[model samples]
Target: MKKKWVHIIIISVVFLYLFLPLAATFLYSIAKEWHNTILPVSYTFSAYENLYTDPRFLQAVGRTLLISGITLVLSVVTMATATFVVFMYLPKMERVLQALVMIPFAVPGVVAAVGLIKVYSSGPIILSGTIWILIGAYYVLVLPYMYQGIRNNLRTIDAKRLMEAAEVLGASKIKGFAFVIMPNMVTGILLSALLSFSILIGEFVLANFLIGGYYETIQVYLMRRLNENGHLASSIVITYFLTVAAISWMMLRLGRRFGKTEEIKEKIS
Candidate 1:
């Protein structure tokens, strides 16, 4: 009983530590003035109102989503294909492939940005200062998450047996992958995509360095306006947190639903 109470106290303290800042930010976002007070002098939605009223803010939101979506799609398709090929055709090279995929984690963002700029600034394909550069950078940034998530999930199933079974039933390699392997991997793919989207949406270093003014993402917009308005910044952070939380919750629901469906299918089979 004493140990359980100690654990409860520790958990409570951690939750309070994590939540207090968010609570304060939410209050500040609505507070008309919080000067030298424990709470706001008054409350209003003007910060959010003003935030939405600005056309640039809307543009930033759209741009952020566009980048995130593009990165998510690119990472998912590429990693999925790569993992499938390595596991199906080139099992012996899995370690090499994993090392290659993990190269991004070893490289610092600043170094990568500089290398990209130096390479693409005056090349045949000038991607520095373009949305393409941001997309490419984001794709690399999220590769590890997508690869590991899908690869680990794939390992849980007997992928070789599944593919062979599909082949024995007279399915082509393409059909086997599309129909058999793909469906089983949907939950993992979706989870990875959500995680990638969240990471890309919150990314700032590459955005600010690679395509700052040419294409303004939410993070870029936030950085630019961070000093101008405290309430507006707080509102942006709150909105971002809410959006990420929603995606996370959706991922959880998907994992549970998929797990149950697979369990039922196993019993039926």
Candidate 2:
């Protein structure tokens, strides 16, 4: 039918729009020289090899992972505890907390970075150029995702009933949370952490403005090297995309396994 043809055309357009740039980047990453041609005349993996072997690039990657990991852990713990408390004992304050979390999204990154610099540059806590500032900024940036993901999952699993049941069986509140609620929230927590990690790893605006020379992340490194070699920059972009995709794929697999285990437990019960 004409409708079916239209649907196929639309789908093809969408796919091309999404992946054409990625295809070009991948091609450029491997191309020895690409000019005045539809495709490169020659290809090589030297760009990738060079990117991987570079000490500075490796150091930037390590630093990025370190900061992103710490930020995820800190954000997860803080958001989880706060979300639990707000949902359980202080449900009335949920609106206030939600509004607070939306602040990061409302404010521009540059404005936030400037605000942080002004507040921390000369205060008793001088954290403007430190990794600690990045951690704090990342924590705020990820708060909404972390809170929403865990809260939705907790609600989906009826965490309140689980907690109450555990407590009814003579377990203390902490014990109930540790043994009952935490297990159910593992998938949601991992999902949020992975999402936040992806965001933080690619973050450049705040990182560049706040702690550019003092601390460099993968994004900063990429920016610095972009002018040096187009092929190398393309390689970095391709590698970055692949790394994020791999981490996301692995986390999704783990999340599905946790979901299956939880479902089996429910069926057994």
What are the lDDT scores of the predictions, listed in order? Answer: 0.86, 0.89
Off by over 4 Å in 2: 248-269
Alpha-carbon runs more than 4 Å astray in model 1: 257-269
Best by lDDT: 2
Per residue, candidate 1 scores C-alpha lDDT tens digits across 115-222 of 998999996998887899889988889988898888866765566788899999999999999999898888878888887887888788888899998988889887
TM-score of 1: 0.92
Clashes of each: 0, 0
Tell me the lDDT of model 2 at 30.
99
Query: Lowest-scoring 10 consecutive residues by lDDT in candidate 2?
Result: 260-269
Who wins the TM-score comparison? 1
